[model samples]
Target: MLVLSRRAGESVVIGEDVTITVLEVRGDVIRIGIDAPRSVAVHRAELLEQLETVNREAASPSEDAVQSLSAALRSRPGNHAG
Candidate 1:
């Protein structure tokens, strides 16, 4: 990881399009602004992790859950089979 010291209003450029600028700094919290084209996708790390977890859960369900859902569907009022 490349670490550089930058004060407020200073910017760090990535490649040719992305730019990260420091907007404000308090005692500990620092606010930053990111400038990139609409084509670029930017997301917070934690939110991305949460979305991945949800996707994994949806992709792979437990056997018990599959059985329960099947049973529920079979027991529905209009689901009788001849």
Candidate 2:
């Protein structure tokens, strides 16, 4: 990690388009603002981890579990499109 000291209103730029600016500081808490293009994605670490786990689960489903789900769906009253 590249560590730098910055006061409120100071900013750091990334690449050619992204800028992270310090907005406020109160004792141990600090607030920051990010400026990036609309196509860029910014996510908190924990939320990103949860999204990765969900994506992994979606990509690799168990065969037996899939069959069970298919059976249950087929048995539903209005599900006759099989």
TM-score (C-alpha) between model 1 and the true structure: 0.80
Report the C-alpha lDDT of model 1 over 2-58, residue by residue, as the tens digit: 999999999999999999999999989999999999999999999999999999999
Candidate 2 local accuracy as lDDT?
A: 0.95
Q: Pick the candidate with the highest lDDT.
A: 1
lDDT of each: 0.96, 0.95
Off by over 4 Å in 2: 60-64, 70-82
Position 60, candidate 2: lDDT: 88
TM-score for all predictions?
Answer: 0.80, 0.66
Q: Looking at model 2, how many pairs of residues clash? A: 0
Tell me the lDDT of model 2 at 20. Answer: 98
Separate clash counts for every candidate: 0, 0
Tell me which residue pairs clash in candidate 1. Answer: none
Residues 1-82, candidate 2: write the lDDT tens digits: 9999999999999999999999999999999999999999988899999999999999989999899999998999987685
After TM-score superposition, what is the CA distance of residue 31 in candidate 1 from its true location, in Å?
0.6
